[model samples]
Target chain A: MSFTLRFGPVFEAWRELAAGVWLTLQLSASAMLIGLLVAVVCAWAKVFGPRWSGWIVNVYVEVIRNTPFLVQIFFIFFGLPAAGIRLSPDVAALAALVVNVGAYATEIIRAGIQSIHTGQIEAGLALGLRPVQVFRLVIIKPALRAVYPALTSQFILLMLSSSVVSAISADDLTSVANNIQSRTFTSFEVYIVVTLIYLVLSLAFAGAFRAIDRRVFSYPVAR
Target chain B: MTRFPSRRALAGLALSAALAVGLSARPAAAQTVDEIKKKGVLNVGMLVDFPPFGITSLDGKPDGFDADIAKELAKSLGVRANIVPVTGPNRIPYLLTGQVDVLVASLAVTPERAKQVAFSDPYAGIRIVVYGKVGAAVKEPADLKKFAVGVARASTQDVSLSAIAPEGTNIRRFDDDASAVQALLSGQVDVIGAATPVVGEIEKIAPKGAFDTKITLREQVHGIALRPGQDDLMKAVNAFVAQQAASGALNTTFRKWLNTDLPELKKPAI
Candidate 1:
């Protein structure tokens, strides 16, 4: 079989495609960091804050987790502009990803918080640690260690799901592949190349997560 | 140790790859007048999703300006017009693969396309223009620098608008012309880049004096496309187009569907 695959045009547009990959990387990375913070806050609120605040967090998490990401992104990009809150595609995409990943991460992080033994927190309090210090020292750090794998996997899934933002004309890697395929009409070749790029990106992210895991979670306990 | 592809899977992959290569090597089948006559049916590919020029009638059959033109061409050849629905991206491939005898899909006569399919004399024309809400103060492409302009993704209008728009112009791309028009109506976008026919439909619903054409981007003339080297069929199709244009029949059809007289077609130089 002598089928020719043309990478010439796809590579010639590398600058734009590389820019698209970079944007996807930046968008997802920022969303992961910010969304993780939101998750931590919401999970903490649900477990320890007032009942009314916990109720609000529960509703936010459920509403976001139940709805499709496509609709969520559309609402942020297309729906919110009606309320005089216009946002650029990249910013809107980032907001939507953070909103989505934060909800799912909230549930995962809550499970992490719940797994902490009550005695550990009580011991910190007995030692006269402040409430914030007790939470940091007794609950959160160990809880995060307990659930780090689940949280990181959810983040990788978020990175993949960010492809949906192309529907709103965000210059992500998938959109770049789409434009290239449409212009070149080499649909097969373009998709193959893009699929490989996405694979490499996922593996790279996995490796980075592993490196972070070694640095943060590998220490032996001070028994 | 089991090989990764597991022999069976490897064979299947090889078979599919061979089939794919074999399909690409298909020689262009030259559609001829006599073959269509023998079949007693002319398969004319036209787009159904595009309005005015191509649309599905209330009866669930393709019927529009392009459909009417296809009917008249088939009538001239004394054959039934089998209206085959085709999309914009696949129309040329359909013609090249001999899946459809001819295309009346509102395909613009572009130099890049000329290499693939032989086009007849110009049969229809469309003018793409930037339109917006009235008093938007958008006079030219440069004036659009500050506004959010929406166009259907990768459409002819999108390409043209991108070429003329300044770097600061934010061109939002919707999935199709309908969505782009919806964006304008919903006030989601400040302006739209679309063809005149789509703009005409928008004008029917949008209040009069509420929207106006900002600037004409480019005028494109469409032609019937036949497979390459279908010289006889190509000549016959061109002759039919000339008759339709001269007798005012095409204009009447245009008015019936488009609610306007046919735009004058300036046929490209042979």
Candidate 2:
């Protein structure tokens, strides 16, 4: 028996793959930005806000982190329609990604926040800096810098996990690759190309994160 | 530095080499009725997920129309039936690779498949239909425009529906029929491309008259598939099918599972 790899058909459907890649980028980028905001707020609530708000944030994090992303997405896409909350597949996918990453990032950012020295915060306050300013400039800046690597890695994972959104027919990169594989019956070639695309995308993201780290977190820190 | 293959190219080479070795390692052979009888067990491949025709029984055994037929065939051949579960995509490979003597896996007979495996007389049939909510205004394939359709990816329904869907028809392909039906039931898609028995399953769970068959897509016949050159086994299987049809055993099984009389079974012209 002889087997040959035919990548011609896979490359011919480049337009669909390109669209899928674009959607993946859009979903990941938007989810990262919004999820970061969510994580920051939740972290603050857990560490400094009122006890009731902290408890609520704790519940949200536990629920999202405990369940599988596939089930969460299914509940939002399929289960929510019963409550008159029917979201389109792409929107549901984005919502799931945001909710999922937000929880993990909350725990990561919380650890970073706790690592911030109490003396530094007090010194900022004593220098006539307002509470909000002290928290944002003195606490959050260093906290984010300390946890930058973990946060970026989580973002990359969120991008990879976005592939499962195709379960709801969200038409992400993996879904498009599957569609092509089915059409062409060139499963190996299609998957190989998709794997390369994902690898390149991950590297590009990692490189971008590194560039951001050098530019934003370059300030000297006392030992 | 000496020139070397890029890492990407090296990875591609290694993957292709591995796949080539794996694919070529399988030794293909056709099984005769005598060999199966000598072994005292007929390794019959059938699907476990597809309902009515193929399904897992409450006792965790394979039990359905296909399973019954496989057992009857084995009994007629004086051999015990060893039902090995197979999936839609790999049923033919199971037959060709000698993993199973024959496939009663609800595999639809088509010309493309005819080139790969020999098909006996169709033992069962299913009607693929465009089933949907009662209120949808879909009357024909052309009228499917602006409607969101769900189908199991790479299925017969997906292939057939993609053929006639209008330019604006929104077809969402799920991983399998269950998921596609889920999308339709949950209002994720306006309609779905599914088989009659699947629609029957949906009717049991969904409210009465909530959905109906919008349009018939294709009536696909399933055959017992054997490795391409198994003329002797093919004849024996066809004889068994003829005897069963004459005895009304096939119809009885059909009624037990699908609650309907067996439609006239015809060997599709390939």
Candidate 3:
């Protein structure tokens, strides 16, 4: 019933929410860094490895994509302890995010590598380039350029999805918002402030990725 | 360019506008207690899994202390009690939206909560209790200084723990009490802080002696929360509680749901 806008205390709440945003950024960045490593190996396996290896990657992607993120988080954070592998919330949340994002990135990077026509590989061979060099210089870099936009978007989605970790008790922005609302009893206002903070953080992440894209793929390529 | 309005189009627009006005006006008309009684339904909100206090049973029926009270309140008013299941963070929102006429959930009567909703007389007394790892011997709140404590999001226990938490203590929060229990069971945290009944429920769910009881932080009153400005409805509920206490019917209802003897039930605060 008390609808007066308490901007002073509300701003104090926003400050706490800012701290949560920092934690969220830390979670998303680390997950993406680890996810990038997994994506590279998985994409490479699907592209040049044995038939069974490709099937393994396919199953991993399908299973992760099919189940809800909430279930996957519970299985890692709650279910793992029963089998004696107990992990902290930060570690569990990070592992879940990386596994979930890696699957999506695998498909995107695989498509980019596959789109490298047969003639491109043959041309590299004709130029006396080794298989590894051809992969590094031609297949990998250009394919990366082709999928840059998709990868950036996936990372942004990963940032957004990281909000779910609040459920597992990661002291991230959304979880902090819950605490602040309980204290201030300003539920709607608290969520609105948190939403705007996420918007700014997402935009900042997109800008940083754009800068990285320009530095990594200076070559003229498009998909 | 202007499009010509047909007779049928005008009629359709009028009907839709009238429907919108009618739906929006429902809550406004429902402001009075007599109107809510005339509608023959008393909407009540409760969490879906808070056992002994409020819960959605395996058969999908509400089965708990608050659930029983809702039913009794409805019967007293000669209306059906329509229960609205809510989450930890959504209880106040449900009340504000007029989705439920009363929130009979295990809601702590905090000053912050009082600002958003009016509460009837306190029905239950609750305290925040801490449960540490078995054999940890954390005797006091200050004893947790060297260890991490876990709690649920947006809970009274969270508030109490944070207020008196040691400077270097690590306090982790989960979405609900179940997850906090999971963290404690998994050894992710050294202690779990929550309501007393919740700690009891956790013991029932987990292995024997998995957790040891610690200090109680603060005692608080739990009340049936109503939307702000619903004075008449508040008065009616207060009167019913008073009559029930005088007739000893409230005590019977409490024993049936709580399954324990609470001497406090004999004295209805109303």
Candidate 4:
């Protein structure tokens, strides 16, 4: 059967879609920043910190990675309030995304950290660098530079994953499309537009990550 | 302007109904009933996912109150009922664009919807009732002032409750009826605005009389819809509804599927 395409109603509701897109961006951006800190700390502990800290980080990573993102968000948004910790939708979305990405990113960053050679550490130490300076200048920068591509892709996945927060009524792009399609009864048209919008958004995030990588990690190193 | 169109259409409907009474040539557009009779099959559009009102049986045929009604309406038209699956978002478009000859989609008769199609008289329906724990003492809308009530956001219950709730009433809106009912079951909300099907599902697990309907917030009447200007087909559908209501066939369908007597219904005036 041939289906007719209708885009007029979807275009007319640009205001709602714009608001939803703004919220999705804010949620993903906040979660990505906070989650990166979480990953770096956890990865460091897993690599060079006390044995007990590594054990604790291992438990967290395992629990989050084993579970689904939908369940995690549901737990934070609906399940946690019963334990007397109430959170608004936006806050819950941020917490869920951070927790989910934190676990996955921890493993990715840990791989980067493990790739650092013992010789590089010795070189920094012999150069009179303190333990902290040696770790920062010799360990973290190159490790991050090594895994930068993988890390950016994970963040882009997190941005797309932000769409799931709509189940908790967090007013993301998917939820706005749902409301519009229900109202207009133009489901195919509305979803086609939303799919294109999400495609453009993913591409934009990829472009931004590339620019950030080039600018921040431009230092030369001996091969 | 679904509302405005129907108001205007009602005036036009009266003239057409009268003009066709003595005329040999029917309006060219209002000729679906003849085409369907010529084909000897009535293509009835309905939703299969809306349970108790609409569902696909394990046998791969549509079953439920709407499905039963669609079949009976087709029988009256002297044709075999061919059920065409249509979702909530597409049912109206499916009918208007001639993908289906008629719709028995449990379509709620609203002014907004009335502008799109001609509605048969109200045959069967559902209600949004405020129900909760036995001791909550929420016997009416005013009594809801002291308790937190949950309802699916942007649903019929939400609109009805919001329109009448007192200034201090704590009304929580969830994403769906299940979540709203879950909020009630968990004691997260004292009461919920839910439809009969949800209440029926809840009754299967909760203790007898654990929660009861304290007040009915609103009732939505479902009507069989045909493309607008189909005066002859609209008359036939209306007569079928009246016949089913009188013969208790509609109530029998309601009890068979919903396990409750049919909700009282009258032709809505919007």
Which candidate ranks first by DockQ, i.e. highest? 3
DockQ of each: 0.29, 0.44, 0.59, 0.13
TM-score per candidate: 0.76, 0.85, 0.89, 0.71
Candidate order, lDDT descending: 2, 1, 4, 3
lDDT of 1 by residue, B1-270 (tens): 775867899999999999999888674343788888888999998988778889889999998889989999999998999899986556765776676899999888877677667899988888999999886888767988888898876577878898899987988876567667866776768899988998888888998889998899999999998877889998899899889888988778878887776777887665
Worst 10 residues of 3 chain B by lDDT: B261-270
Give the C-alpha miss distance for residue A167 in model 2, angstroms.
1.1
CA-only RMSD, every prediction = 5.2, 5.2, 4.2, 12.1
Question: Where does model 4 sit among the CAPRI classes?
Answer: incorrect
State residue A117's C-alpha deviation in candidate 3, in Å: 1.0
The candidates, ranked best first by DockQ, are 3, 2, 1, 4
| Least well predicted 10-residue stretch by lDDT in candidate 2 chain A | A180-189
How well is each residue in B1-270 modelled by candidate 2, as lDDT tens digits?
899999999999999999999888764433788887788988899988778778889999998989999999999999999999976555665676677888988888877677667899987888999999999888889988868999987677888899999876789988767778889989989899998998888999999989999999999988898887778998999999999888988889889999998887788899
lDDT of 2 at A126: 98
Which pairs clash in the backbone of model 4? none
CAPRI-style quality class for the chain A–B interface of candidate 2: acceptable
Error of model 2, residue A141, in angstroms: 2.2
Tens digits of per-residue lDDT for model 3 on A67-185?
99999999998889889998888899999999999999999999999988888888998999999999898798888888899999999999999999988888898888887776776
The chain A TM-scores for the candidates, taken one by one, are 0.96, 0.99, 0.93, 0.96
The worst-scoring run of ten residues by lDDT in candidate 1 chain B lies at B22-31
Chain B of candidate 1 vs. true chain B, TM: 0.83
Model 1, stretches more than 4 Å misplaced? Answer: A1-4, A117-128, A184-186, A220-223, B1-50, B53-105, B116-123, B166-170, B182-189, B224-253
